[model samples]
Target: MKRVVFAVPGSLDTPTGGYAYDRRIVAELRQLGWDVECLNVGEGFPSPDKATQSAARSLLLKVPDGQPIVVDGLALGVLPDVAGEVASRHPLLGLVHHPLALEWGLSAERADALHRSEQAALALAREVVVTSPATAKLVASDYGVPAERITVARPGSDPAPRSSGSRNEVPHLLSVGAVVPRKGFEVLVAALATLVELPWRLTIVGDLTRDPNEAARLQASISQHKLTGRIAALGAVPSKRLAGLYDEADLFVLASHFEGYGMAYAEALSHGLPVIGTTAGAIPDTVPQEAGLLVAPGDAGELAGALRRVIADAELRRRLSDAASAAARTLPTWQQSAAIFATALEKLA
Candidate 1:
């Protein structure tokens, strides 16, 4: 049987878009009749300390020689040395969501350091798998990876019932993602603060505990803007509850600074919800122009204007909602993405 070891950085069940993509794709790979073994390579990725680095390095070296190993970029990008050793002994494939250096809020020195290491690690991999064509192009142009060696396997969207939408006079807005600095939750808060005059409410769904500092800052923003009553932050909701929230919402919004593929945007379209997002990372690709209004990242004025336009104009919201459902039909399935991953593995083998 075809076999490979899938080394992920954290628990498969982590409540985030990247982890969700990892979890779904791994399951789909198993269903495709491949002997795919999953390994939790620890959580200290992209910035592992000495102990974590040593432990992860030792664990990977124990894999049988010549075995195919696909390492998630979270861990792989920071472990250039370990990746080099593994690539020499086995088929190494790097699954990159995005380059580590482009993440928001990084100092110049740290970003450059990550850039050098990731470039080295990606070079050692026999093949690379990315979540979006945009990411593939970025890797090739910036990291010096050959475009031909990279495969774009975007996250799949399961068929979901069209949102029933809100029954209240006030429009409901939903923004789903982990509470990290990269998500631009504070920007969203600031935008919403200006829209207090509009009849709209926001419900944020994400893991607040992931970044305590960001979470605390977000709360401060909420209180400072007097949005404590207008916006509800529900931390890391269950799938069923999240689905229900989506079903109840009229519009979906997230002011992310950057995204590898913006899986949440795709999921929102699948629910037939109009989107309010910033033009960052792969979001413009994930969210079609017809499906929603997009603003410049970190521009609260533009974001507020976009939110106001959608919230006040019921006809505009209806038009975008219709377009969202059409976009959802174009999304790939998890099985299809796994087939792409399997094909990449086969070609390298």
Candidate 2:
């Protein structure tokens, strides 16, 4: 039997995009009869430190000597030397959720270092899998990876039922993601401030991370904008409950600074909610124009206007709702993503 190892940062319980991708892919591969193993390299394994490098090297040694290994980009990009060490002995693949170089909040010097590291890591992979065409292009242009060697596999959403309630009430807008700078919660708050008199309520569903400074900054901004009454931040709800939230919401909004695949946007559409997102990263590809609106990132006025238009015009909302539902049906499931990934591995085997 052929074995495949998926190396990633943190455990399956980690609430980040990379962990979600790893969990889904591993489950799918097992169903397809591939011998799959998952190794958690803990948090911050990719830092530029001797201890982190040693830990990464140790992780490379644990993979079965001859098995093809799929290293998560979070772990792989930080430790390019480890990829160099393993590629010679194993058919190595790199699964990138998004390039580290394009991550939000990085300084120019840090971003350049991440870019160089990712470029070196790509050289060591026999194949690379990315979640969107936008990311695939970034991998090619920035990391120097050939376009042919990269595979675009989108993430999937579980089926969600449409909310059953009276439609005559005021519209409720939903935004789901971590309370980090990259997720652009501040942008959403700023947009909400402009439409204070509108009869709409905004619910933010995401957990605040361990970073106190970010949490404090966002809280201060919320107060400064006087959005306390209109906006509510409900940190991390269970998956089962999220469906209900989606059902009740008239629209879904994601003002991310950047995203590799924007899974939440897809999830919202699956629940038949129209979307509003920034034209950053892969959001434009994920959201069909007919299903929702896309605006420039950090443009509070544009986001505010879009929100107002959708709220005031019932016909426009109905049209977008129908279109979003149709688009959601066309998305692949985790099983399909696994099948595509398995086919890629079979060729290399």
Which number leads on TM-score? 1
| RMSD of each predicted structure | 0.7, 1.6
Model 1, range 52-121, lDDT digits (tens) per residue?
8888889899999999999999999999999999999999999999899988889999999999999999
Candidate 2 colliding pairs, count = 0
Q: How close is candidate 2 to the true structure, as a TM-score?
A: 0.96
Candidate 2 residue lDDT tens string, 270-292: 88888999999999988999999
lDDT of each: 0.93, 0.83
Residue 6, model 2: Cα distance from true site in angstroms: 0.7
| Worst 10-residue lDDT window, candidate 2 | 161-170
Name the 10 consecutive residues with the lowest summed lDDT in model 1: 39-48
- Indicate the residue-level lDDT of 99 in model 2: 88
Give the runs in model 2 whose Cα sits over 4 Å from its true position.
45-49, 165-168
Candidate 2 local distance difference test against the native: 0.83
